[model samples]
Target chain A: MNKNINHLVNETLDSFAHLQKVAAPDGLNERILQRMNQPKGSKEVYLFRNAQWLIAALVIGIVCNVYLAISYNNKGESNGTETSTISSFESHFRLETTTNLYE
Target chain B: MSELQLIAELKDGNQQAFIKLIDLYKHLVFNTVLNMVQQFEEAEDLTQEVFIQVFQSIQHFRGDSKLSTWLYRIAITKCLDWQRKNNAKKRMNSMKSIFGLDGHQDIIPDFVHPGIQLANKEKATMLFKALKQLPENQRIAFTLIKADGLSYEEVSEIMQTSIKSLEGLMHRAKENLRKSLEQFYKS
Candidate 1:
C-alpha cells in the first residue's frame, strides 16, 4: 500500500513536469520600463506636489500676523487718546470747581 | 551580449541593456513565481516587481552568484512576501466574518495552471491542493526541484542551504507530499 501510494504521488507530481511557462501579459515590459524611467522615491514628489498648499498656508499665516499687529496698534492708539481726553476733562472740571469755590 | 557585459551596462544605467536583460529572464522569473503563487495575474505582477527591483539594485549586486541565481532569489523572496501578506489578509477577513463585521465568503483555492495538459488537469489540480498545504520551505524545495527544473545544487544555492540539508529538505518534501496525497486520496 505504501509502495502504491508513493508511486501515485510520483506520478501525480511528474504529470506537472511539462508545465509550460506562462507568457507575461502584453505591454508588461513596457510598463516596467516606463515605471523605471519615471522618478523614484515618491516622498519628494508628494512634497513638491503640495508646495502650493504649503506656500498658501505660509502666506495666510503672515497675513494674519500683520492684520493682528495693525489692529492691536489701532486699539492701543484709541485707548491712549481716550485716556488723554479723560485727563484733560478732569483738569478742566477741577479748575471750574476751584473758581466756583473762590467765588 | 555576454552576461557580464550586460551586467556592466546595466550597472552603468544603460536602458537598452536593461531591456535586453528583461527580455532574457522574464520567462524564467514569471514561471517560477507562477508556480509558487498559483495566481496568473499576481505572478505576472510579481515578475514585474522582481525586475524593477533588479534594475534599481543592480548596482549593489556583488557578482557573488550568477545573475540568474540572484534573480531567482529575488523572485522567491517576492513570492514568499506576497504569500505572507495574502495569508494575513485572509486571516483578517476571516476574523472580520466571525465577528459579523463582514459577510462570510469562502476563499477559493486557485489551482489553474494554463500550462497543464488537459488529460493531467484533474490530477494536477489535486496535487496543487496538497502542495499548498505543505509548509513554506518544503513547498519551495519541492517546487524548485520538481516544477522549476532546478538542480539540487542550484536549489541549494538559491535557498542558501548546504547540499546535505537541501537533500534532506527535498526528501522530506517528497515524503510529506506523498502522505498528504495519500490522505487526500483515502478521503
Candidate 2:
C-alpha cells in the first residue's frame, strides 16, 4: 500500500515533465483584432459615463427652478399688497371727486 | 524591433505594433490561460480578452515590469475572474437543485492538456483535478512554475512575492496534491 501510494504521488508530481507548449488556435489573432477594432465603449459604459452629467444637470435645474419660484412668489405677494392699497386710494379719490361734482 | 521600441509603438497605437504584439505573445498567453482554465474555448476567449485589455491599457504600462510579466498578470487575473464566476454559477445551480428548480448541473469532464505526452495523460488529468482543489495562490504558483514553464524568479516577479514565499506555497501545493492523489488512488 505504501509503495503504491508513493508511486502514485511521484507519477502525478512528474506528470508535467517534458510537456510541450501548445500553439494558439489558428486565426485567433484575427479574432482578437476584430474584437479590438469593434467600437470601444459599450452602451452600458456610454450610459454610465453620461449618467453623471445628467444627474448634475438635473440637480442644477431643480435648484434654479426652486430659487426662481421662491423669488417670484415673494414678488407676487408684495405686489398684491401694493395693488390693493392703490386701488383703495383710487376708489376714495373717485368718491370725493364725484361728491364735489354732484354739489 | 526592440522591446522598448515595441512598447513605445504600442503606446502610440501603431497598428503594425499591435499585430506584432499579438503574434509574439499570443501563444504564451494562450498556453498559460489554457493551463489555468483547462478548457480550450474558454481559454481562447479569455486569451483574447487579455490581449484586448492589454491593447486598451497599454498607455498605462509605465514599463515598470517586463511586458511579458504584465501580460501574465492580466491573463492570470482574467482566469481567476472566470474561475470565480464559474464557482458562483455552480453554487447557484446547486442551490436551485436543492429547491427543485430547473437547474442543470455542470459536469466537469476530464481535461487532458494538449501538450502532455500520451503516457502521462491519465496521471496529468488526475493531477489537474487535484490541482483544482488547491487554494488560489498555491494553484497559481504551481501552474506558473510547473505547467507554464516559468522560472521561479519570473513567477516570483509575476506573483509579486519573494522566492521564499513562493517556495512555501509550492511545497504546500505539492503536499496537498499528494494527499488528494492518494485519496483518488485509494478510491
Candidate 3:
C-alpha cells in the first residue's frame, strides 16, 4: 500500500512537468529564416568542401580497407603456422566475445 | 490540397503551398522536435530545418511513409546531429579546461519543457528526463508510443523492428524510466 501510494505520488509529480508554450519572445522564426537564407558565400566553396570531405573519406576508407584486408590476410597466413592458430571453436565466438570484451 | 498537389505546386514555384505545408506541420514538427530537444527555440529551429530539408529532398519523398513520419525522421536526425556537435564541443572544451586553459563547459541549449504544465511537475520532468536518458532505440520507441501515441505495431513499422523487438525496446524503456523516477518519487 505504501509503495502504491509512493508510485502515485511520483506519477503525479512526473505529470506536472511543463505543459505549455510562451511564444519564443517573437521574431525568433524570422531570425531563423534570415540565418537560413544567408548566402553560403559561394557554391564553389561548398563544392570544394564536399570535394575535400570525399577525398578524405576515400583516402581513409582505402587505407582502412587495405589495412583490414592486409591484417586479415596476415591472420590467415599466420594461422597456416601451427603456433599462431587457436582452436576452431574460437572462430564462432569472435563476434560475441569481442562485444563482451568492450561492454 | 493533396500532398501530391503540394509537391507539384512547390516544384512549380508556388510559394503559398510551401508556406501552407510549413503552417500545417509547424506544430507537429515543433512538438516532435520538443520531445527530442527539450528547448522550445531549438525545437522551432529544428522544425524550420526539417521543412527546409523536406523542400530539398522533395524529390525523394517516395510516399512510402506518411509525410509526417518522414518529417519526424528528418527532424530527429537533425536534432541528433546537433546534439552530437554540441557534445563534441563540450568534450573539446573539457579537454582544454583540463589543460589549464579557460573555456566554457558547453551550454546545453535551454528550452521550456511542455510537460511542466501538468499538476505533477517534478514527476513529469523526471519521467521525461528519464525518457531522454534512454538508449537511442528505446528513446525513439518510447517517444513514438507515449508522445506520438502510436500503437506498438505502428512504432514497429516506423522503427523497422519486429513487433517483438519493439516490445523489448518498450519494456526496457519503461523499466529505465521507472528506475530513474523511483528515486525522484521516493524523495
Best by TM-score: 2
Question: Which stretches of model 2 miss by more than 4 angstroms?
Answer: A40-103
lDDT of 3 at B136: 81
Candidate 3, position B45, lDDT: 77
Native-interface RMSD of candidate 2: 0.7
**Model 2 agreement with the true structure over B1-187: per-residue lDDT tens digits:** 9999999999999989999999999999999999999999999999999999999899999999999999999999999999999999999999999999988997979888998899999999888888899999999999999998889999999999999999999999999998888888888
Candidate 2 chain A weakest ten by summed lDDT = A81-90
lDDT of 2 by residue, A12-97 (tens): 89898878999999999899989987886888989989898999999999999777666655554665643343454565578789
Clashing pairs in 2: none
- The candidate, 1 or 2, that scores higher on TM-score is 2
Model 1 misplaced stretches (Cα beyond 4 Å): A1-7, A38-103, B103-106
Q: Each predicted complex: what DockQ?
A: 0.42, 0.59, 0.16
A best-first ranking of the candidates according to their lDDT comes to 2, 1, 3
**lDDT of candidate 2 at residue A80, scale 0 to 100:** 61
Tens-place lDDT digits, model 1, residues A1-103? 7787767777886777887767767787898888777876688788987897999999999999777666655554666643343454555578789999999
| Poorest 10 consecutive residues by lDDT, candidate 2 chain B | B102-111
